[model samples]
Target: MAPDDQPAPPLRRRGARMRSAVLAATVDVLAEHGLAGTTVGAVARAAGVHETSVYRGWRTRENLILEALAEQLDAAVPLPDTGRVRDDLVTYFGALARLLATPQGEALLRLSAERDDTLPDHRLAYWSDRLDRGAVMVARAVERGELPPDTDPGLVIEALAGPLFTRALISGAPLDATLAPRLVDLVLGGASAPKPGA
Candidate 1:
């Protein structure tokens, strides 16, 4: 076939690139205008796509925001397996506390706070998944004899995060760097420790 007569290869849309664009735009809109300010049209503009394109991919603004924020949350907290329960809990919560202490992390919390009835159930599911990942990691440690088998993973996870969120959202106190790991140790170690009277 003559070079000029060769048919052009069918153009393929890059799924990864498209997803990256969407995630990037989500973060941009979040950082720029927060949750209330974020809209399909604004995110589309930021991502260099039409509003309909975003809607086609995510179906709604709430869905798009949830996916984007979920991506960041996933990156923020990885499943911990450091071979020691105390070490693992410390590593996990410490990282989370650090993230919450940052400007982007604070903004992310604010975005979550702005959620209304229009928000989809998937957003709640997304957070639930993140919580489950942490729970599973701790559960494994309990199963391994590193932590007491009776130790409640859900309670442990809550203890690790509850105070941080409460202070940030309610009391307005700063997240003290020294307190996070110590709190993790108290819960995990306390549960596994033998009773003094026993």
Candidate 2:
């Protein structure tokens, strides 16, 4: 599927500016109050626009928030087809490590992890969408006989990304691009299923 955060085809100048302002407010609100408190009214206030503008434009608070998340995720980590799973993973993870160390990335991670049943499902769906898109890499590796057929792509992603998140959010360890290859090595060494007839 095409990336949901693809740039708008085009829009009138006023409309485009409004949308950009709203998205900027969305991130600000998420950083300040998180998911539960971020609403169309709040974002509109922060953006200095009418609530109707935000509501009419985004339809729901969830969409506005997710637009911000999707934009940042797309900018921070791009999935490239390098014809080799390990190389692709290294590139992806290295970029992620760098992003996670940034202020916006850290705020996004904290807000994304918030658990609020009253909120729209977009917060969690953001991750589901990410995994869905990322699975293509693992699937490609499987086709190349790098990973076993039964190996779970989502789990593999977790194995690779989870540690980076931990180091960034929990452990407060310094992040380095070099960690990407080491992470790929660890994930691959333990990722694939048992060899045939071992």
Candidate 3:
């Protein structure tokens, strides 16, 4: 049999590469076109894959977009364990602010805010998962006594992140270098664990 006649690589091996390419393409499309303009055919063309493949893998454009956004967030904003709650939060929110300042990040922020009645539950689930992931920073702070035991991790995260989003998506304010530390200070001031016997 000729080499040309050889069958293509097994689906499992090719699946990984295809998945990565498709996700990357999805992000690029989202950044360039926004959520309303992104389509499976566009992503498939960008990724050099068939439209059916994307449909088969992600089931819908919403799912594809969500997975792509999740991947970007996980990579761009990491959970820090610097042993000091202030430092960890500063570092994490710093990364988040930086990401939000970028065009791609701005697109993601807009996408997250979009309201789709048909996918309200799915959107809530997506936000819930992301908030839960970010809450780890607060959880660690509480464990280390850097924050009060009763501190609400999700609320703390929201408090720190809310202004950043507002600045990026609403106020047209700059996400400057000092912003993260300043926000962290503001939130942590009220949330910090009190000094012993004081």
Against the true structure, whose lDDT is highest? 3
lDDT of 2: 0.80
List candidate 2 segments past 4 Å from native: 1-13, 32-42, 45-48, 190-198
After superposition, the stretches of candidate 1 with alpha carbons farther than 4 Å from their true spots are 1-13, 191-198
lDDT of each: 0.76, 0.80, 0.86
Q: What's the TM for model 1?
A: 0.82
Off by over 4 Å in 3: 1-13, 190-198
What is the per-residue lDDT of model 1 for residues 1-198, given as tens digits with 9 covering 90 to 100? 889996433123236776778788898788889877899988877777667768778898877888888888678867678888777878787788887887777777766666578774665666566777788878988788877778778877887888877766678788877778778767755867874446
Ranking by lDDT: 3, 2, 1
Clash list (residue pairs), candidate 2 = none
**Backbone collisions counted per model:** 0, 0, 0
Check candidate 1 and list the clashing pairs.
none
Model 3: lDDT to the true structure = 0.86
Looking at candidate 3, the ten consecutive residues that score lowest on lDDT are 6-15
Taking the tens digit of each residue's C-alpha lDDT, what string does model 2 give over 1-198? Answer: 479976443233248788887888888887788777888888888887888777788887767878988887787799978988888889888888888887778888877776766444877777878877777888888888888889788888888888888987789887887788877876887447553334
